[model samples]
Target: MLSIIVALLVNLLIETSVSFSVVVPGDPVVAHVGSTVILPCWINPPENAEALEIRWYRKEFSNTFLHYKPGKVPDMPVEPYRNRTSLTPRSDQSGGLKDGDVSLRLEKLRVQDEGSFRCYVSGESSYDSEEVDLKVTALGSTPVLFLKFLDDGRVNISCKSSGWHPKPSVTWMSDERRVLHPGGVFYSREAHEMFSVHSWTAVSRSDAQLVSCSLSLKTGELKDGRMDIQGIVSSDSSGPWKALFFTLFIFALLGFGLVGFFLYKCRPGKKPDKEIVGDVNIEEPRKHAVEITVDREHLHPDLMVTKNCKIMRDGPGYDHTGEGFPYELCAFGAQRFTSGRHYWEVKLTQENTPPKNYWLIGVVKHGNFTVRDRSALTPSSGYWFLCSDGPNGFHTNTDPPVKLSLTPRPERLGVLLDYEEGQLSFYNIKESKHLLTISTRFSGTVVPLFNPGAGDQSPLIILDCTKPVKSAEESSQPLLSNNSSNA
Candidate 1:
């Protein structure tokens, strides 16, 4: 009887000595925006955790990001994490909890997603928790330089870049390697918590030649852009004006000779059937081109915009409604138009293996526009869309919807809106063929809208058509109004 009691007591002691603890990564996990990363957390001894309750939450929040109660399904995660957070399986054949792996797989990481997360595991008799830190970074676009003439005979050089996380440092330098002190600096934070910066400096015309702008981060990522201002100034006190005059004289003689030849070709009976104007043979569409940039603040959470605001693509995770539109990947233009003619182009590519199955591009009114309902896309509802579906082909979003028959589908689409004329037209820029036109009276302000559609990896790019004019006469030529309102 004494030996039996002693053996039972030893067994009890063995059972009591079994330990329960949590293991987490010693270092913080670093991930880029629009990428997937794993936050590791697991039971130290590798026991079956399938029956244990597992909960993951942000260290600063009470709302759980993920919660699993043994045999029951997980509860809904917080808004920002919906459809973006999941648990990795410990093995291919068994559920993750069975092997004590509670690692969280987060997709389409955003700048605001950086922080510490707590993973809690609870069993019938033991409970343990661990904290893991995640850091998110975004590389910004290449810097761009803009030049403006100031009233004091100096030029204002502005350098701009977007889509950086934790901000970045910008510098201006002259061709002679002199560092410049920027007059002003500005920063804006996007909805994703990334940043955009603009810095400006005033320099004399002589010092403006070959100005360079550079943006850099602590991680050794750097981008540089340069602008040549020599052409902007005709001559400086130390420059050779006589040589410039001689060059102009030679060009003038050549221009006169070309004009004479053109006149000789059109002389009386020798006139050709088609008239030639300048170097172009065809009458191009009225040039009303505008530079379009995506509005980051209004972008869908599951959509990623390039630092330049020109390219937009569907993010990695499945789509879920945290706020605003529920099932669509949408972004708006940064500029809005209330009047006058405006035109912009979007380029699509077949480089994506299967190509994108669905896309929508057009304009939408500013107020009371709900992107929540895909069916509400119509002119009456303040939306004018030219949509394409893989199976359904192309169509316009009208009251009854109009099916479009287009041969050799367009890869580059040009949208022309004439607010005063009550006209909206679509064109295949590659073929220079007009596709469709809708006549509708628009009121108030309207901004460009873009949707790349779900499951499509292809990005929609806004093409920049603005270029520097060579002569003052060309620069002064009357073109479409370039004024725009903030989107």
Candidate 2:
């Protein structure tokens, strides 16, 4: 007749210094009120089950209390366990039925325990072993934090305490040990492998000369760590402010002198101080063409038509293109030529028809002309363009050098000979603006004319073309296109 037993589920074991084992009945059991408890138990093979005997006991006056055999413990109380103890088997859970887990349990444990208890589960002629110990915790106190600075201007605050089942955490107070508004504080734990309690703090100096570090720990214990930290309190070095001050002082003196001079000259009572106008600040040297000797008596008819004479077929040297229209000025005649002033006439026509295209000339940067868009003019200091003669002058004709001319007249345009800038432009003298500029070569060889008829077609013509340079002011503007060289 198999019986079933059931009782406390908490297991207790016999404790050795390093390990504990489940108590088998009949063994002396020792227990500490606040220490852990373990129940010794193990599994028995089905064939080994019947012979087992399990018992529960206590050492009040030193003796066994109850005996467990199969489904029931015998009818004896053994005194100390008269009502305080009971041992029963679980049919549903015999000792180690699954894998030799003969687990047992205990209740209302007290200290002063110092012996082995047992659950004797004997197999049909043998038994196996399993056990556990019961331990109680009495953590009784909280941890605290302390603050201090090291000798080398470092912080040496520490946190510590005892009376904890596991250590407790201690964090530094902000206001000298009390909580304060925005005091940056740090934390660390108690120095224990149990990971119980901890404490921490941040140490900083009173001024910019101070260095700070944060202590982190679980036990809030003390240990040496790198003093190096993240927050920077101050800098140790100074800069060159003194040098800069001296330099600026000298500059102020010079500026003061100038201001004083101005105030004295233009005082309210002084009728706006005045001085004779100085020479004009011209970009180029003034000296206009002093004197000019015409190579031919009769100029190119084309030069006469629009009065764009005062020119020569430039370049046969450093002139590269052998092309540019090198206009020479009749410093005196330029002003009157456009207004239709009369001039003495000499004659010398080209020995042969001076070709269809030749240079026509006009003043560029002076007289009636000026470099309106600096981008269109080179900054060669002495550089200038020939103003335009009328278009009909040299662009087209039966005899270009003769059909249209550059001598005298009003509009702007003339045979494009060559130039330094990439493209050459023709201007309308009468209209006072650029007519158009031509690109790409019209013909290979350009001819010259000593004197050609005037008043037929274009005026100022470019002989060789080169890229135009942008003046400082023009360079600041946005570019139009990659190919565009001038405004």
Candidate 3:
């Protein structure tokens, strides 16, 4: 009887030790907004967890995000995590549950997703819980600088950017490195829970030289944009030139030959007609055709790009594992533009396919292609795109996505970039219909980007359009006019 009692006690001790020892990651898990991250939890000593119950919930609110049992299907997640959360096994073999892995996978991480989570496991007579902290980070767009002449004679220097979480800070400084306070600031929250900020500082003519604008996050990410105010000559400095031009104009008007010349130059009904082609009315300043090829080095892992960098398709073996984070099936063009006007086209090659379920075409700052977060693909992040998704339809990838009404989607799309004018326009090449235009000051070199969403086997083919040639008379004309008024 004594030996039997001793053996029973030993068996109970071993079973208790094996069932109740739960382990979780000691350090906090860090992830970016719109990214998927894993919160690791497992049974110590590697005992099978297939028959146990696992629950992951917010430590503060006790709101469950995931709950799983061995034999029955997991319970429906709460409102916030309806379809965006999942459980991952610890081992690739035995389906992970048998290996005691109970890690929780969170998809499309949001700003509110940052906090402590509790992983609770329970068995017949053993129960244990561990806490895991999740931290979500948001990276906003590159700062853009704008200089506008105010009606009161002060120069309004403004900076704007979008696509940030946990709103960031904006600062303006003069060439002397003195901080300038903003006269006004504006912030807007986007559909994806990101932020856009526009801040302006009014400065006197004397202080217009080199002004800088910076955007920063608490995580230490910073982007700066600077403008040379000297290039924007003050209205006061051009007063003498304007007066001289006025006197010369008065003298010239006194001559009969000058009067005839002026009448010819200013003919009321003789305005030059702009060129119109197909369905497009070409009102642009100068159209220069550019050849663009894909940049394979920056392409996402799930994209299969052709050697010539003209075609792209989804990788056959790419898997999403059902997590709802936006998959990055994008590639960047090799060409970079900083000045002048350029036009390029992309044609969809697949036939008999419903309009692509997802597609994106736009320009991004040279290095921004590597950012995996979808929020980083906003205008504020140095990215401007026209995107079409199955649910969202067609829209400009702005802070507040601007929905487009495109009838008979064009298979061929045209992109026009006017660097000097701070304009990016899109057109339906096949239909010759104008789609949309984005106006924003660009601070640095930008490259073309294409994201043919996952599973989209259709290729995006780059087309070669003929460049417009200028006639000898048009080419010889002075590009700048000395008689232009400064005001």
Candidate 4:
């Protein structure tokens, strides 16, 4: 009976002294680049892990990613995983080292971090380990589409995007859902281990088609963009027929020149009874590009202007003094225009924000010409500007206020102030389309005005238009009065 009891007690001791196995997630842990992730790992049966040696490594046992022991200082991981790796409790388990949680906390995850990690733990008697798989992914930025008219009369559309991991797939499709063959696909890896993709396709211009390009990952991540390519062609993309017609017309002009000379020499001399005495004057719009900067003294308290005075945005939680442009988020340019034509441009998508919906961009009378509300912002009251009220639409601050219909809203707005002509014109610099013109008489100084309305994420940025650039098509067309409102 005594022997039997001793044997049973020894068996119990053996069972209690047995080693514990390391437990890790059965499925691969997924995380995105530039994010933090916890690779779950723990010891079964919950034992104090503080006294045990913990090591996390990649392929080789000698390659230590993270090492910890009770009395020894923590070992630094490999160069790649140096400061980014730390031992912490599993997300679901809060007991940490005391409760046997030995999870690895990785910060600023990189694409190279996607692999198998071995979590090894050792006690006085035995050691065990388990491997955890990590999968990293990155969703790229929005794809940008570029259109080019081929010499063969086909429209070539190209799509480009960057900052994606795992090599995304590209798909080209039409509005009818028919898949089109891409001309070529090219990809390059960036310094950060992310991929940039560029693909293009050529389509006939015979039919109008709405095309789309989609970038996708096997992880069900997608970024897509669409552009209407129907009848898409550059303004000067006329075929060879136009050149042939010009050649023939030049020959015809030469033949007419000879015949006119013959007639002048053969016909009798004749003189007009009255000599033309009136002078026909032709004037072209003069471009006087001036560098504009925000006047810090007159800036609204709620407005935040950059140090360069080029960018302005709303600053919330600002205390109003109830003086000087109260309740208005406005800033005036330091450069004033009393005469000549001054042109400047504002970028509506600065500071990584989306296209602005609410903004007021134009010129206001310099000096103490202050108005309380929209009603007071009129030419008669010395304020002439164009306003964008988001989905409510766009308008000008004329006497009665003229509403405007602008298609494909302007991303880069060009403002021209003809101080002598008393005309303020707005142009969509991206599309080269004239938006509107305000006609009024100017007397004193007028400064460039800007108001980034509330409820927008982007900052109003005034670009450096020291030398205003104008395309041939933009310069040839005259500003039409059909869209103008006389103030």
Candidate 5:
């Protein structure tokens, strides 16, 4: 009887030891937004957990997310995790519930999901709980570099990017890996709780031509952009000649204006014809026509781009493919404009398809083109667009969205980007009308934007705007200027 009692005591001690301890990953599990992850948790001795009560909670035991027990249906998870939570094996090697793998499988992970999760398991007489750390991250858009000529002859190079979670570190370095001192750094929290960062540094002509800016996250995701200051910096040497020519050209223009004004006055009551003036204003954008093609690398996965990258349409798949622009339903232009004027046109109507009633046309800072929501596409966020809501009306994403009444809806839209002049003008090419002009100080490289709204039957076609430019001798009259808006 003494030997049997001793054997029973040993068995109980072994069973208690096997069930009293829980094992979890020592390192924090890292996941990005919109992804799925498994927080590894299991019994130390690998005993079956099917009959044991399992609870996955955060912060404390009462704040449970998932609960399960033997011979009873599992209770509903908390509201935020209604259908996005589940139980699964820690990995392929895990033996699953039969062998005590009670890892929590989280789906559709969000920024708010970053924290500590407690994995608690209990039997009739023994229980164990362990904490697993989770880290959420979001890799934001590429950094965009903007160059501004400071009054003191140094060039102010600004770097900006958006949509990053857990603010990333910005680094400005020369091609030789030398660190640079930034003039200013600004960070703004977007509507979606992501971070947008902008930093600037001034460089002189004597500095190296290649300057690169990088944004890095703790999870090892990094984005970088570079700018060549050779062209801009070298132009400084010709400043005197450029100024002299500019002064002479201005005097010549004044002389011509005076002569034209006197000649018009001499021809008493000879007013300009409205038709001719309208035609000239409408054709002004064509003078700066440039060839533009869609950028496949920056395009949304839901968009099907042609081989030539000139046409784009919505694809059948609505789910993101984890490539290209993860959230934006738009495509970027391959051509980038840092200065001077440029114009391109997009065709909204395709043969055998319904006319496109919904579209978004505009320009965005190069490298800062990805956007998750329309509300974040404001000018302050480095987005300037004209949205057409399919029979609802036309609007601009200004501080307070401006609504415009457009008649005889445009089939082909012309976009004119006057970078140095700080103007973005839209035109109705078919109707020979100047639609609207948005004025804002443009910094950095800007790229054309196009969005064929979902459910639209037609695709957006980028036409080759390489038409011949008109010369001064061919002009019959000066172009009429459109009023500029704060947009």
Candidate 6:
């Protein structure tokens, strides 16, 4: 019993010899406007030292600081940090007595709390050595995507935030419950003391409606703006629709003016309006009419595609591909394009038979993304067709072959290719949308691309591609007609 008592006393003495350490205040940082914040901190030594008192401190001047004493408050501290501090002891977290987790916890944080902090501790030994420092910052106000008005009845929107230590990203969402990806504007400028971003996209297209702009940051998610307008507007209609559209147009234009003033006067850095990042140059015209040939191969009705340039699936939530092949990245190509006044066109086809499942087009951008339409071409007898329009201009797509009346290649004029069972498509110098399943009798998407009409923009890259196999021959026999069926 005597020996055991001696052993216990020695152990307690050794433990009491370790120095106290800090748990919070390591570096300066930022917190979103309304985030439940934690101030990380820990002290040194080992296990026995866990019971040490934890305190939080803030240095006012070089030598003066405001600190909190553990268990109970110390006599009286400086006026600045009197009632604004707290200490949380975490024995399980402290690196044993060798280290301590005497961190600070601050509630209902305010903007002024952005600065340097200290994790102080009190223990048995000499009340001793400490841990490290921490920095706190005032994050910017929640940035709200503002849907304001524009002149001429079009809609204009912008995103704004303030007080953020590091810049945040802003995105726009429409009533379609889709994200409007921003493509051109990735650069940002400093506003007052925080970061600010203003992107302009003229909303003028079919089936347009309500939208929301979302702001995200390292701090957290903060949505703060609302759509300020009379009502909804559809891009597919005219007239009375014109009234609401025009109203949004005028308001959006006005919003544009306000954003311009703020961008010019408040924003620190600026770039030329026309210097778009994805801008590629193309001016060469195709001299020899290129040919697309296909050969019937596999006996499966699935999609497969082959192209010259590598593809990039930029929009969020999309992964490249699978099985025998993977996507490779490369530079972009230029294809000729004539703005259809306001949108672009694409021809869609279904090689086998149209499935009950549906697909939509996602326009990739950095901040806001735009989805053209859910049903590009509806299933007709064996195909589907559509004419799509948006702020990006106009575009046409393939439809299930219509019954007489009248239905040309793509409403406009382009190359149309398909098979008897399914697989429909129309591609020009500028773009291509080959989404379909080839009849098992012909399972391969091998379209030998030919440079047509004008311009070199006929990029080697083909987008939204399904699994396609490469082919290089123009077969005429019905049994041998690969149909190149995969669009």
The sequence of per-residue lDDT tens digits that candidate 5 reaches over residues 247-359 is 54333222334443344355556664322112336566677889998777666766776666776766776664433322378789889899999999887775566567778
Predicted candidate 4 versus true structure: per-residue lDDT over 251-271, tens digit per residue: 322233344333334546644
Which is superior by TM-score, 2 or 5? 5
Q: What is the lDDT for 392 in model 1? A: 67
Between candidates 3 and 5, which one is better according to lDDT? 5
Candidate 1: list runs displaced more than 4 Å.
1-11, 14-17, 60-62, 76-78, 89-99, 150-154, 175-178, 207-209, 229-487
Candidate 6: where are CA atoms >4 Å away?
1-64, 67-75, 88-101, 122-155, 159-166, 173-199, 207-210, 219-231, 234-487
Error of 2 at 283 (Å): 99
For candidate 1, list the clashing residue pairs, or say none.
none
User: Stretches of candidate 4 above 4 Å error?
Assistant: 231-487
- For model 6, residues 345-434, the per-residue Cα lDDT tens digits are 222222232211111221111111111122312121011232222122222222212121111122112322323333233233232212
What TM-score, to 2 decimals, does candidate 2 have?
0.22
Give the per-residue lDDT of model 2 (tens digit) for 1-487.
1222222222222111122233343443444234434454544223333335655444332354555566664667655446545432434545443344444445444432334554445544344443333333224223333344456764444333322332232333343334312233322222121222323444555521222222333434332222222123232123266446434433322233344344445557665432111122111111211222232222321122212233333211212232332232112222221121111111111223222233333222222121122222321111223322234344311110113233333222322223332233333332332333333222121222222223212222221112222223122223212111221
Off by over 4 Å in 5: 1-18, 235-380, 385-487
TM-score of 3: 0.47
RMSD of each: 17.8, 40.4, 16.3, 21.0, 14.3, 20.2
lDDT of 1 by residue, 1-487 (tens): 9999999999998897676898898988888889988898889788888778888897643768899897697888879899999989634554577678888999888888898999898887789888999888788877767666677989887787667887888888888899989898777664456776778888997656788888887777778889887765644443466556534433322233344345546568765532211222112443788889887666676676666677766676645433333325667888999999888878775453444556789888764223656654656546787887766677677644666666666777778888997778777766766666666789778999888765554566677756532223122222221112122
Error of 2 at 441 (Å): 99
Q: Which is the leading candidate under TM-score?
A: 5
Better of 2 and 4 by TM-score: 4
Sort by TM-score, best first: 5, 4, 1, 3, 6, 2
lDDT of 3 at 419: 90
Clashing pairs in 3: 141-380, 141-381, 162-380
Q: Comparing candidate 2 with candidate 6, which one achieves the higher TM-score?
A: 6
C-alpha positional error of residue 58 in candidate 5 after TM-score superposition, expressed in Å:
1.5
- CA error at residue 438 for candidate 3, angstroms: 12
